[model samples]
Target: MFHRSVLVQKVLEFLLTADDGVYVDATIGDGGHTLAILNAAPKATVIGIDSDKSALETTKERLKFFGKRLELVHGDFENLDDIVLGQLGYGSVDGVLFDLGLRSVMVEDRFRGFSFKKPGPLDMRFNTDETLTAYDVVNRYSPEDLERILREYGDVRGARKIVEKIVDARKKTPITTTEQLAEIVVAGLPQRVHTDVLARVFQAIRIEVNREFEKLERGLYAALEILRPGGRLVVISYHSGEDRIVKHFMATESRDCICPPGLPVCRCGHKRQIKILTKKVVRPSQEEIKQNPRARSARLRAAEKL
Candidate 1:
């Protein structure tokens, strides 16, 4: 069920204020927000970048009507600097948006192994070039390693039991498919627990396979660097971990001091770089969430460069 971006109106209202300057949709997943921005600023040029070639291709076809207004680039959000300065030949941008996390298409594609509801390949990589897959982690990771991923990434309550079951199952035969692994984890859990926990486990594997957190850290900072003074940076994250990174980055970027709280003097000389536009993270309205359950977890945060 592909749905429009959670905060389309809000994002467009903020970005469209800039009449003709360049705008970037960092995670241009399915071009949901991209379309909104393009419609809002018809004369403004947009650089839509996505790590998934398939996504860029689909977006290209979906947005074919936009013609020359949209410039679709195939690359990871982490390569924002290279794409912006090296390829586009721009030192600064007017606005940038990141609707982070897995897209609805990714979740819906059982072949991607992002959702536990259906069985598919244990491949969670966004880009096909990546060697690591969910299969590699599930079958090869040590028990402690599996436990760490489950505990840290999944936040699963029965991480120990689940990891033990995984290690035990892999010994008999390599866990080659999503069903094989999901069955192992499901069997390890109590019947009373909902399948949502299992979903988190899958999410953990996907995140590990793609190094999502690291990419987000690098990508957000890159956006900060590429943005022109007074340029707006809008980010929409779907999970707690992703949200925490955005929260911290926005807070610190808008802060003046990095010293300890007790220290009165400014020793670090950290100057504020951004002015936060949304103090409280904006969430999808109830109507939107009802229309698209996936949007339930979405949170939007915006800031302007100093």
Candidate 2:
């Protein structure tokens, strides 16, 4: 089974409004958070979106109880505007939830190659239809491109050395599997380096293959644009990079002016779009983490549209 929803109670409390409304589960994975939302708001309708067909299938089975109340869409959340307008028509959705983390299904399915711990193909695409796979990245990318991805996406240490190893290994034979890539990364780094080095390298490759950061920025802006005034936008991010983007986006949108200091007059004319609800980022409780270790890294932030 996929991992349990992270920070469920908190998500429910912050995401649900007093009256019933439509909500969008931007990264509806296995529908865990979607299920929570539906349960919390009986009259609410949810439009669940995911890039992975397998995930959508599993979500369908799991959320079958909701029937017409839950509508599953096989698409990326980055196209939130198109999906929302196509399905529910224009204007107002009460809330949008973005849970930006790999579900257990992705990591546990060896064929998907999301986890280096499992030996599998070097295909780390969230959507199976994507042409660029980790195999292509590892075997075909130039050393400079490899280094750039490792540095910018994974923030991996010794990125240059890792890329050197990758270049040398592929010259001998194509790197076709997750294990092969992990071994190459490990072999290139000093033995003293933590095992996490391999994970970071894999993360970098996955991020590149999926274009996660680019999609995230687009999706967030779309979500904000689709929300009705006073509607809520909630996001649960698993890493510092993702959290930073969400934080800055919400902060920027919540402010009345983004003009540089000492601008003298209000020439920017930037009106506040949303109000930050959680003054501090909300974290999963120790009890929730103890129950589901994966929730340990979750940081949730919410804002209400103005």
List TM-score per model, in order.
Answer: 0.96, 0.96
Each model's C-alpha lDDT?
A: 0.86, 0.88
**Model 2: runs farther than 4 Å from truth?**
188-194
| RMSD of each candidate relative to the true structure | 1.4, 1.5
Per-candidate total of colliding backbone pairs: 0, 0
- Candidate 1: where are CA atoms >4 Å away? 1-3
lDDT by residue for model 1 over 1-306, one digit each (tens)? 344677788788666557787899998878888887887776888899988888888889899998988899989888898899899888899998998876777878888887778778889899888899999999888888888888887788878988888888899999988887878888845676758777789888888998888999999899988999989999888889999999999989899997889987889999999999998888888988897787888888999998
Give residue 259's error in model 2 in angstroms: 1.8
Per-residue lDDT tens digits for candidate 2, residues 1-306, read: 676788888888888885579999998998988988888888889999999899899999999989999988999889999889866675679999999967887899999998888999999999999899999989888889999999988888788988898899999999999888888789735676746897788888888999998899899999988988888999999878888999999989989989999988978999989999999999988888898998888999999988
For model 1 the TM-score comes to: 0.96
Clash list (residue pairs), candidate 1: none
